[model samples]
Target: MDADETGRPARQLVVWRPDQVPAQHDVPGPGDLRDGTTTGRLLIRSLMRAQLGLSLMCLAVALTVTASFPVIAAMVPAVGRITVAGLPLTLVVLGFALYPVLFAVGWFYHRQARQLETRFTELVDPPRPEDPAAGRPGPDV
Candidate 1:
């Protein structure tokens, strides 16, 4: 229940050092911004590229596993017995289990990335003002 000099939470006291105050850059007021708009197409493109790369890697792994499961099964007898219940262990392990879990993980990652992007866009792009000078008639007549 400790309060600091400013009556803020104790966490605020941690930042009350005697050193020089951090430089305060002038915040750009709405009037100072010219043609204000949040253009994040590059960020969107980067996220898409990242997801594409992930999908490509996942496909590569799938292909490699498909080409090698038979050889592996031939080498190790235990590879044939990896079941979780009364089902064929192979069906339960590979078909019922691994793929769904992999897909869920990929989906979770994509969703989290998208949500983070949305939060970033909200933070970095503050609201724009309705420009008073936008539709004013020119001083010609």
Candidate 2:
């Protein structure tokens, strides 16, 4: 079998070029976190606000859907007596309709959370250029 100079099997070795070396400025320093710049504070506040808003919206939807059942039952007793496919209307609505509303709330919450996280990530860590020599052999050491 073919072997390299060290008698090991011929395999590619990465040789980083001068330009490939990461610059010191590219890395975040301790002060970047501790400084609490206006932009950083703004991002933090924005994230908190977004999370709070989403939570409140989900809570409102859940509360409204859940509370409506008892209110309707009390205000209009006849509604409870109504039947659909041999099942009481209240039963069908409570058992089946509620599930879709809950599922919809959950789906909306998940989608909003993901979008918020993506925005936060992009803001905190700007995308860098792809490495040209990634997964490929470079000049010999």
**Which one is best on lDDT?**
2
Question: What residue runs in model 2 are displaced by over 4 Å at the alpha carbon?
Answer: 1-34, 131-141
Model 2 TM-score is: 0.64
How many residue pairs clash per model? 1, 0
Q: Can you give the lDDT of residue 109 in candidate 1? A: 62
Task: Report the Cα lDDT for candidate 2.
Answer: 0.69
Instruction: Estimate the Cα RMSD of every predicted model relative to the unseen true structure.
Output: 16.3, 11.2
lDDT score, residue 45, model 2? 75
Q: What TM-score, computed on C-alpha atoms, does each candidate reach?
A: 0.38, 0.64
Write candidate 2's Cα lDDT for 1-141 as tens digits: 357688776765567443344323444322233455555455577789999999899989998988888998999999889999999997898778889889889888987887776666555544443554333322331
* Residue pairs whose backbone atoms clash in candidate 2: none
